[model samples]
Structure formats: C-alpha cells, structure tokens
Target: MNAIVTMDALTVDTGVRDLRAADHLLHTLAAELALPEDAFGCTHLVRGDRPRVALSLAFPSEPLLRTAQERLTARGYEVTPGVPDPMGRAVLYPGVSSLTGTLTIAELLSRSAIARVTVLGSPGQPAPDTELVTRDHVRPHWHDGELVLTAMPAVGGTLVPFEVPDPTPCCADH
Candidate 1:
C-alpha cells in the first residue's frame, strides 16, 4: 500500500524565499508519528511554470503511515491519494502545515549522536536500519530551496536514515 498526498493553494509570503520551513514542518510531522528520523528523504525543488517542493518520506510499517495521513487531514490540508513509488513501495504525501523549529538534518543527527551501528539486510534484500551506526557521515545540503541529504553507501546499497534538527527555526511566515 502506497499513498501520495498533495496540498495545493498554500500561499506563502512574497519573500519567504525557500521551502526550508516546509521541510521542517515535514520533519516535525515525522517526529509526531514516532517514525525514525532517517526514514525521510531530502526535499527537492520541482522547477517548471510553477515551482513546488518535492519531498519523500518513508515509514517502516503500515500503521504509522495511516496515522500520519489521519493527522495531516485533521489539520485542514488537502491530501492527495496515497500511492507507491518507483520501487512499488508505498508513498504518502504529507501536507505542509507549519514548522515548529528551524534546524537542518545535520543538526538533528548531531542531537541523536549515534553511539553504535547496525545492519539489517541480506543480498537481494534492501537493508533495514543500515545507517544506524554510521549516520554521522550523512550530510544535508540545501539545494533549490530544499534540503538534500546525502547518505554514505553501506555495502553498496542506499539506506534511509533519520535525524532531529536542533534549534529548529520556527515557521514565522504563517
């Protein structure tokens, strides 16, 4: 089961400048869901006639996804039909409500300050919690007004990790 959610007609200030605030809101949503911080991918900019922020969030289980959807809808944002990604894996679109803090993935990871490492994958199977131990190597950079996280490849496969941004800048433009 995959889900895709999109919130349209959200008006921001003229000089809001970037989607960093939006990304931070997504991060907060993930935390609210109790999902691991690394499960979300970096937010990217969708350039075209009208630009928008494109972000990818992952959940290790199904129940978590449902809860997130329900929470998002309750907040009065329009959610798109949930769908799957290119990997046939479920995908859910989280509406940007408001950001409570302003911190980057790097800062969040630092807060976690991983003390160990673990790998949960075998050949032909995607590794689970692959970056738990070496999460410090991951770096987040802002690209096109979105946060881009680059993770270190472990065993030649990519693993999604989570982080908690510190001193998260609040979305005051609301």
Candidate 2:
C-alpha cells in the first residue's frame, strides 16, 4: 500500500485482494491517530493484479497530519507529504463500539460509508433482507448467520480483520 499525507488528509492506496483488510487498516490508522469520524472516506480502484482500494482521512490541522505521518512511518509505511484535492470526498466514521450486537442497515449507513457488505465466504454478495450487523471494533461481523458489514475505520474506531490473521503479506510483493 502507498500512503500520502498532506496538510489536509492522509490517503492510502492498497493492492490487497481482500477489501476487508484494507478497510480495517484505514480505520485502525484513523483511530490510532485520533482523527474525527467525518475525516474518513473509502473507494475501490480498478486494478489488474488484485483488488485495489483507496482510503483517506482529512486531517483537521497540520500538526495532526505530521503526527499521523510520523506514526505510520514508524510502523514501516512510506508516508509522503503531498497536496490533497480540495474537493475530495469526506468519509464519516461510524461510532460503533467493539461489542456484539445487532444494527440495522439504515443505522449503519447513518454512521459510515460502508461501500459493501457480504457474507463470510461469499464476496460481492449483497446484504441480506434483514440488514442486521454485529460490530467488533467497527469491523462488522456476521450477525446470526447473516451478512457482515465491511466498513473503513473512522476516527475513534479500529479495524479488526475477520479472516486474514495478518494482511501485510499481500503487500510484500509490491
């Protein structure tokens, strides 16, 4: 993954096959950096090798941007300082706790911009009729045999992987 930090935002471009992992990383970073929920945004990019995804967070100040850069860099990420687009979309973080419970689709959407939700083994599948979700550190897990809501991390939230124990391996070849 490639990360760019500016005075206004932190953007991450990931090439991992699993979108869940990418979203987790983005959200985790935001929480670690103490960014606000409204600062997060996510989008899928078209790529040939694997599933490419881009996640970003708008920093409220230059100090926050520098702090986030330093933190990510210390964690081995090559954070580059750049100029972010003024009109880029802002993604809001969902304030879901890391507890087990049920949430409706509307409630989830009101808190996050989760691009998609699917079953554990089924990728690209739409959410079920009930649209109920279970939260585990903002990483939506399957609730009562239903679908899992995949969302990018917002401020005050962290990412928890559902399947992959570690997602760094997928980026090694890059």
Candidate 3:
C-alpha cells in the first residue's frame, strides 16, 4: 500500500496451501482484525520441509503490529513476530479496491497507492492516457523498494495486469 517501506513485520502461517486460499485468508484476517488503511497484507511461499503459503502483515507502527499479533494469535494462527525473507506479493493494501475496471494510467497513479506502473518488455512507462483493463484483479508488488504494477499490452492497444486472476492449468487440455 502507501509506499511499502522497511518496517517491523510479522508472518502469519495459516497452513494455506495455495495463493488463492492465502489471499482469502489474508482478506479474512484483515477484516476480522479491522486493519488500518496503511496495513499491508503480503503472501509468501514456503518451500521444502512442510511446503505451504505464508502471509505477512505489516503495520505502520509497533503498537498496531502488537495489536495485530495479539489478535492473530488469539485466532489460533502460528504468528511469527518478524518478516519473511523476500517479502511476498501483496494481496491487500491501501486503495486496492479502487483499481478494478478500466483506468487511465494517470488515474491509476493518482487514485491508488500504487506508485508506478511498468509495462512488460519496455524501458519506458505507459502513457498517461493508456487504458489499463484491470479485470477486477490488480495485485502490485514491491519492486526496487516501490509499489509497482507490471502490465502487458493487450488487444486494442490497452494494457492488462501481467498476472491474471485465473490462469490456464498446465495440463488442462489433456
């Protein structure tokens, strides 16, 4: 959300095995805890030795962090009191909901907490008038210490998020 900075972070491991479930759990926990606008909900992948998806929620202050930890602990999650290595993809952040539908590149930057939108395979940013078809799913990540969205050119010269909501299965046609 608002400029993902280096902050005291906590890891929430709910034993969710996949990204979709992890995202749901993150939203659920945030709602249950009444997370503040600046609070960040990130998803991490835990590989090997009990592979599963882990979540991280970082608040703007230590008091909020403590409160979240206490609440998550009360909910019976294995809450670790620190951030995981390679802070995972953000599933919940400030102004995330406003990114749905189609938005101009300028409107996207002005309206949402996302700091930058980088088009795939391009060294330059998309034009302000470029339409971004959000498709009801816009998930940005912390890149180079900034909250950035990666998009690719689509039909009609519009752009779409690099990661779609529903991806084709690896062997679906078989």
Candidate 4:
C-alpha cells in the first residue's frame, strides 16, 4: 500500500485488497502518530489491477502529518502527498488488550457494528458458536472462505475492534 500524508489527513492507496486487510497496520500507525481513535476512515477507489482502496485518517495538525509521513516512509511504506476525503467512517481502535472477561455474540454486537462472525478456511463457514474469550490483540484475517476473527490467549476477554470484510475482489477483479 502507498501512503499519502497531508496536512489534515493520511491516505493509503491499498492495492489489490480493500482497507480491511490493513486494519491492524492502520491502527498501529494511528497509535504511533498519537491520532485519536475516531480520526480515521476509508473509501473505495477503482484502480490498478485490483481494488485500490483509500484509507484517509485525520491528524491533529500539519506537523503531525509530516511526522507520520516521514516515520512511515522510514519504515518502508511509500509516502506522498494527496487529498483525503473528509466523509470517511470513524475508525475504532480496539487496543491490544481486553476490556472484560468472557463475552457472548450478543455482547460483541452491543460493543460494535459486527454483523457476522465465522472461522477461516471456506468462504461461508461458521464458527459454530458465539462464545469468545479475550487476549492481547483481536484482529480479523481474510481467507478464501469466510473471514476469521481470532485473538491471543483464547480466553478471558479483550476489546476487539469490530470490522466488516470487504466484498471486493482481491485482484483481477472479475
């Protein structure tokens, strides 16, 4: 993904896949830049060999944006300057820690806008249960099948940022 940092926002031109796969990276970057949890959002861009997703995140100031660009560029990401949309959805940063003990599917829904949960492997496979424990980081993984959500520890409970899988094709969009 190529990142574009400007005075007011951070834009990422993600190749092939949408911003869903890069949620963790975005969250990490936001944390590193000290950006507020609600300062980020994404929009779909039609380009390249696949979907060119643009993730635009707001920074507190121009200096912070420049700092983030420099830091991300130093970390090997392609950084540049570009305009970002101001109408993106607010990104929720579920920290790398749990907020409570065990939780049910109902509880998870109450916490975020997660519509469904399943395991990895096939596209439509279900996890067979709605019970989950917490751990360090809770992130989603995309597979050929359904998107699987997993975390560390596999018990207790953590605050997982709820995200929906992008239905766009990975590459060579058919």
Candidate 5:
C-alpha cells in the first residue's frame, strides 16, 4: 500500500547497529523526553555494508519536536529534522501496552491510536471478535496520517501481526 504522510518527523542516528539496541534506545529516549501522548516512535532498517537501525519519531506539536531534538542532541545523538521513510513500524505509540497478549479487533482499535486493521488477502476485514495473538510485538505503520496494522491468519483461526518480533534470515545457516 502507498503511504500518505502529512506529519512532521525527526530522525536519530547514534550508530545503533542492531534492532535490540535500537528498541532500547527508543524507549529510553521516549521516557527521558517525556514525549507527549501523540508521539510515534519507529525503527528503520538501514542495510548495506554497515548495517544499522535508525530511529524516527513523529510529534504532534512543534514544541514537543523541538524538545526531543534538543534533548537528544544534548545526549550526543545525531538528531536530524526528517525521517528516513514514511512507513516506519511503530514501537512507541498510544496504548501500546494494551496491544500485548490476545486482543479482539475491536479492543485493539478502541485501546490504541490505530485507525484501521487489515488482514492480508482476505478480501475483507476480519470480524471484530476475531482474536489477534500479538506475540508481544505489534508494529503498526502510519498511513495517511492514521495508524494502520496488517495481520495475517495464523493457526487455530487466530491472527498475528505481519511483522514479528524476531525474524529469520533467508539463508541463515548456509
């Protein structure tokens, strides 16, 4: 799906070289900055010879953005004024805690900033009562200024997010 972004963003590059570290830093920064309720924190994979995970954040207000930039900069991070890409998997967002464990489609929407939930190749949305086993990792993307999650059907007629917490490489043991 195409992304339609009309939001202000900031990026941080502290040479974070892995997803785990990036996730930890994102949480630390969010707490240290006391980010406002509407903030979104995401990790973008920068793959190449020198692979790394880059952090991006979208703030609802200018003052909040500036404060984040200032505080992050003070901590020796390379804080820039824009994001690497529009589609970032959210790590910190409203009601993120409620997304853990099993939840109904209706419960997910009611508890979080997510505006829509879609299932892959289903031809239609899932029933509200359909359960989503979050796997303790629910990464929703920003679409048209609204948060959207895409899940896939799993065993037992339940669902799981498309992006998992731990992913295997194509030829890991080759």
Candidate 6:
C-alpha cells in the first residue's frame, strides 16, 4: 500500500450534551494534523434541529489534506473539505480539520495568526541578502511558515513575503 497518511479517528455523540466531547475531538484532530495551536472551533446547524460542531485548522497544502482525509476515512469517519472563503482556497493538511482557509503572508501577518515569517534564499545556492523567487511552479507546501521561491540570475531578485511586490514582475505568480 502507498505510504499511510493522516492520523486517527475521533467520535462524539449527537446533541449539545456531547458538545464538550466534540470540542475535544476537534482539538485533538487539529493537533494531530499539525495545525497551529491557536486554531479555533464553533458549533453549527447542519440539518433540521440537529447540529454539528465545525473545527477550523489552518494548514498549507493539498497532499497534507489528502493524508488527513485518508486517515479519517480509514477509521470509518466521514470528512469533507470546507468551502474556501473569499480568499479562494481553504487549508489542507495531513489531516482534515473543521474549517480552513488559504491566506497571503500579509493577511496571515495582519491577522496575527502566525508569529514569524522567513524567506528561503534561492533554489540551490545561498546568496547573502537575496532569496529565490519561483514564478512558474508552486508547491503545496510553498505557503507554509517560511515561503521559498526559485530565483533566476537575470532577475537578481529575492523572495519577499507573499505580500510584497517584485520590483520587476518578470516572474509570473506561481
């Protein structure tokens, strides 16, 4: 079989009486998915009178998400990818969380969701004060904590926070 992905399953009974159990389940799932410790959750009505809680885990990619989903599915748990907000995509990690979102560095920084950000310099070589900026291809993990880009000698550029603009927009947005 392919490498196993994701972690484990958690369960909670239906109704408000099981809210705490549900909350703890979500929390545990988030942690297992490697979601940041600050991720939050809430309860929502899914069908007439019956309600289920939604847990939000913020992550960086699709493979990570597939892994999480597979794990839950293996344990007989149903998982669904939540709709993305105006941002256009939701977070996906090694495990599916309650709710998720894709965000830019500025947005993440502005929201104060992440504590710090770093730029990886170049694709294979080190350049003092410069970083790689890839414009054509993007990886699922590219948006994680420290964003790295592929650098071209002609561009003489560096990877800036996703929020910043390139002096020369020659590199296309990946």
Quick one: best TM-score, which candidate? 3
Candidate 2 per-residue lDDT over residues 1-174, each given as its tens digit = 112222366655544445666666765776687776445444334356654555555565778777877777787764545423333322233354323354544555555545345544444543333344344434433233222454432233332224332347656988
Off by over 4 Å in 4: 1-7, 14-16, 41-43, 84-87, 92-174
Q: Write the per-residue lDDT of candidate 4 for residues 22-83, one digit (tens) a residue.
A: 56556666667777543433343456565555555556467867787777777766554654
How many residue pairs clash in model 2?
3
Question: TM-scores across all candidates?
Answer: 0.38, 0.42, 0.91, 0.43, 0.84, 0.34
TM value for model 1: 0.38
lDDT of each: 0.37, 0.47, 0.85, 0.47, 0.84, 0.36
Candidate 5: stretches off by over 4 Å: 1-7, 47-50, 168-174
- What lDDT score is found at residue 139 in candidate 5? 84
Model 2, stretches more than 4 Å misplaced? 1-7, 41-51, 81-174
Clashing pairs in 4: 98-158, 122-145, 122-146, 123-145, 123-146, 134-156, 134-157, 134-158
- Residue-level lDDT of model 6, residues 1-174, one tens digit each, is 101111221221234333345545655666676654333222232444655543333334556556766666675665555521211111222222221243343433344323234444433533343433324222222233322222234243434333222233445675
**Model 3 misplaced regions, further than 4 Å:** 1-5
Encode model 3's per-residue lDDT on 1-174: one tens digit a residue: 234446768998899998888888888888888888888888888999899998999888889889988988998989987667554688887888888889999998988778889999999999999999999888888776667899999999999999899888779999
lDDT of 2: 0.47
Q: Which runs of model 1 end up more than 4 angstroms from their true locations?
A: 1-17, 81-174
Model 1 has an lDDT value of 0.37
Show the lowest summed lDDT stretch of 10 residues, model 2: 83-92
Best model number under lDDT: 3
Better of 3 and 4 by lDDT: 3
